[model samples]
Target: MTDRAGHRKAAVWGAGGWVVGVLGVLVALPLAARDRLPDRLATHWDASGGPDSSMPFWAATFVPALIWVAMAAAVVLVQWRARKSAGGAAPGWVGATLGFGGATLLGAQASIVRANLDHTDWREAGSVTVWVVVTLAAAVAVGAAALWAGHRARVTVPPVAGPTMEIPEGQRFVWLSRTSNPWLHVTAAVTGVVAVGASAASVGGLTGAEAVLLAGPLALATVVVLCCASVQARVSEKGLDVTFGPLGWPARRWAAEDIASARVETRTAAQVGGWGYRLNGLGTTVMLRGGECLVIRTVKGKDFAVSVDDAERGAALLNSLIGQRSRG
Candidate 1:
């Protein structure tokens, strides 16, 4: 409990400090160079890396800061809700977003200020291609670092006793459960539509960079749709078998002997990270939705969890099988 409290406190302070610092830098950079900047700052660049859109000097300064604040608020709200629901710290992705997004915004804001400095008009500002590339690279580095830190700081939950079923001699027992997230199905459908549209557009004469952009999203959406649609969990004498997606080609299995223990746990998306497959301090969780999950500790001391209905019974049966194997 003390460790959990400390983790929560640290997360809050780290997020708060990072938000304030990023916002401050975003707003301060433009103001500090106000005298040397143009009346209008070049805020948008065309595909050719030429300035094509401009905003007033003051707008350029506060707009990015406001955007950053809004994003930070959304992330904080997610963390707060997760804490309330599961009493766990927000997932590592939250910190990664703050780190990468904050750095990207800061870099872009600085680039705009630098590009507009000493220019009489926004149109005369130089291209920011180099700055954009560098900013993205730095953002990725920061995001990865934040993810690592979050994973390291995670507090592991202690083992808990779970329900068990009595296995009679010469009797076969098997349990099966499947869980699906409707929201994920909706997302998959939407992305699939967008991907199909992009493919059609590409075939209909959209070429060059535009087609390339469409292709990237098309491939990404297809992968998301395929992987995150649904999940199935089965437990029997063969142990636990978890298959994913409609085709179920990607699957995970654990032998009865490999399982150290089995338990039913109440988990939330915030605790395990967002929907789909997640890896955090707690362990790997196939999280389709929030609520009851079948959690098992492996002989190697690793943990794996899957959300499903009748998880208590499934866990009980798995434990029973483990006991039978030990006796045999």
Candidate 2:
């Protein structure tokens, strides 16, 4: 789409999504729950797939609706302002996504509320598994949408200079390593232990099936931490490389000629949301945790950085390789 058209279309979608989502929570939900809202509504859930907390009907409905309204307004306003930036930026894709997804989520929750409003036995009214499924799906959808849109907004494609940065069949090799924080290990260990204890405590609140379903992702997250706790970085005249231990997943290499610059940078979670693999204006960043990073800017202005020890040496070596190759 043309810039003007894309801007208009995105704005319209943002506004409409916010409006529909808010309206669904305010009007559609109330109508659906009509006479069913009990003296007190089920507002919170416990481990056993039962309602453990209650709220007055007005507070239960209005409080959430107010939050949605605020979020929706903020999203639309931010997006509109971001589009006006020099590079035609989109509002923080994160916010746009939340605007879009938050509404959908709140609406979904409203539906669940209406569905599960059986005061006679609120615990038995709705499927806890269903709530989990809807929420996960909504969150994933929002993230996916934001990433796609953000990529379009932030990255300007670089000009290809005819197969740049090709190594002559392993003619040269260089390697280095970067160790992560021991504190990260401690955090992961604590999380795993806490998760284990929580799961055990809450197992009685759910059926055997519910427990298994919920355990799936938590188990996967723990496994990921175990596998990717440390990052090993390597740089060669050929390019740059990084790999994770244990699983050794996502082994990556970049060509030296493609690099515009390599610089030492310190990044924060607020800059790229959270750690792990993050994307922002600079491009893909494989951040293990927040701290010093070696950022490589591509010829196209795209970038990829990683937080690791000895970032200065890595950036210097990588830059020297690029300089030497260009001089050759």
Candidate 3:
């Protein structure tokens, strides 16, 4: 088989092996300690690090496994569709998701088991705060590793020569394009609603520690709603200008002289490390969706890209401007 086919096979097997391994570990941990565990396990903890929910021993073991299975299936389906459409190896996000999700589930399961071990009653389980923090850190590290591996595994495609526009002397040109992810918009709306609710709760009666918990989520939600919902790209004689959100106060600008080259390239969320405003091996990318991106190489040898419609024209205009600036 060709190298491409081999890579695809490896990706499939790798994902399958990861899924099975995680599932096995999730099931085995609880069963191994069944004798030492209570009839029910402390499965949920509240803000105070106290057990506020319990699940039957068997339920706790199988429920997480089931959730893992469902998530694996969804990831597999998405990768399959992407492979079929792109006719390339699995996207990097697939590995990242599997790594992150599997590690997170395994960590949470281990924490539950450890907390409930030797306890006659589920309510007597100890706080999982330390374990939770450790788990989060481990999961993030594994996810980053997996993403790097995927990037290394990717088959590099040769960059194609992009179309360039001819500019007449004394003529003016400007290009503008906007891109938005509906999913991100929905996410922002949901987070905005939560922030509003939390603000109301804080004002209504919440005080002290209770209000502090609300404050964290409220601030996080507001930031997400403001910064990650949408993006707009504009190219003019001045250079490339990118703005975030509806108000567009926060923006990035590249002056014409600072741009080394401008071109149109196709990029996917998986290629640039998933979702909005990503930094990875490919440099910084404002990825709203997978399609044509206006990519620029700065004079400082850094790369920047933004997913946008009619990227070809935008890139052409930017190139024209750069050429004119260099000649002058």
Best by TM-score: 3
Looking at model 1, which ten-residue stretch has the lowest summed lDDT? 199-208
Runs of candidate 1 exceeding 4 Å displacement: 155-328
Quote each prediction's TM-score: 0.48, 0.41, 0.49
lDDT of 2 by residue, 135-248 (tens): 567667656755554453343322212334443443564546454434444444444443433343233221245645565666566556644555657777778877753224
Q: Per-residue lDDT of 1-328 in model 1, one digit per residue for the tens? A: 2324433544455466667767766776677668778888899999999999999888998999899999999988887798688765566688899989987887788678767777898999988898899889989987987786566445242322244477777776667666666556556545544543343333322223685587688668756654665676878778999887644547899999999999999999998888889999999999977888999999999999998777888888888888888989
Backbone clashes in model 2, listed as residue pairs: 48-205
Please say which candidate is ahead in TM-score: 1 or 3. 3
Model 3 spans > 4 angstroms off = 1-164, 206-209
Query: How does model 3 fare in lDDT?
Result: 0.75
lDDT of each: 0.75, 0.58, 0.75
Error of 2 at 194 (Å): 7.3
**Model 1 quality (TM-score):** 0.48
Tens-place lDDT per residue, model 3, 32-61, is: 778888999999999999999999998999
